[model samples]
Target: MTAPTRAAPAREWADAFAAASNEDPEIQAHGKYFTCTYLLDATERSYAIKMESGRVTEVTVDPGPLDVPYEFAIRATPETWRGFGEPVPPPMHHGIWAATFQRDMRLDGNILVLMQNLRCVTRQIELLRTVGSPV
Candidate 1:
């Protein structure tokens, strides 16, 4: 047998996500939080979020190359800086409220991305929290 090789690079996860959409009449009637599409801008060398309503709802990413489709647009908050000693907002927590936002509001996916980024940018703040300091 020959050596196993790596899998093909992902054109973009968005392609699969879009294909999974349920177009059933019943499913369509049910409201969703937000819809939007994204594209990789080779010129900008970054992914761009395109909104139908000037907003972004939810996005899920596994790993590797993935492309998301342009769909619905809903207002979504990316990352915001908080004071060191200040507590995080309830909406910011990945709890039921946030979950609702994810399901109903379509703000579910990309949570891990947000958390990972937060950890990177707020390392000092997190360290203080770990030490029993208010944050």
Candidate 2:
């Protein structure tokens, strides 16, 4: 039998992240009310991900200080982000809450928005295990 064909890998972290989030079944099924924009700040770089009804509308890379508008920001050191990039993150690196409380990670800006869309946000971020971290 011929070998199975696999789609070409994404060229960059942003591309991988977008592809992963956009094509996820969980996001599509439960994201009907998940609409928001947020920043994933890795200290080394930043990604502004905008979601509309559970779909990733846009993903801006390294936006200027005021170029892109986001409701909240998940900020962390590059070192901390590397831990998240792992396929199986270590104890303190497992989730946003864990890292935020245990590592050098911060959730800033409008926190209520983050909480409002917490479920989808959590699922989207969990995609990092498959898509890897942007840092």
Q: How many collisions per candidate? A: 15, 0
Candidate 2 ranges beyond 4 A from true positions: 1-11
Q: Work out candidate 1's RMSD over C-alphas.
A: 15.6
lDDT of 2 by residue, 1-135 (tens): 977522222237788888888899988888898888899988768889989999988889888989989999999987787787778888898789999887589999999999988888888778887877676
Alpha-carbon shift of residue 121 in model 1 (angstroms): 27
- Give the lDDT of residue 77 in candidate 1: 26
RMSD of each: 15.6, 6.3
Sequence-dependent TM-score of model 2? 0.88
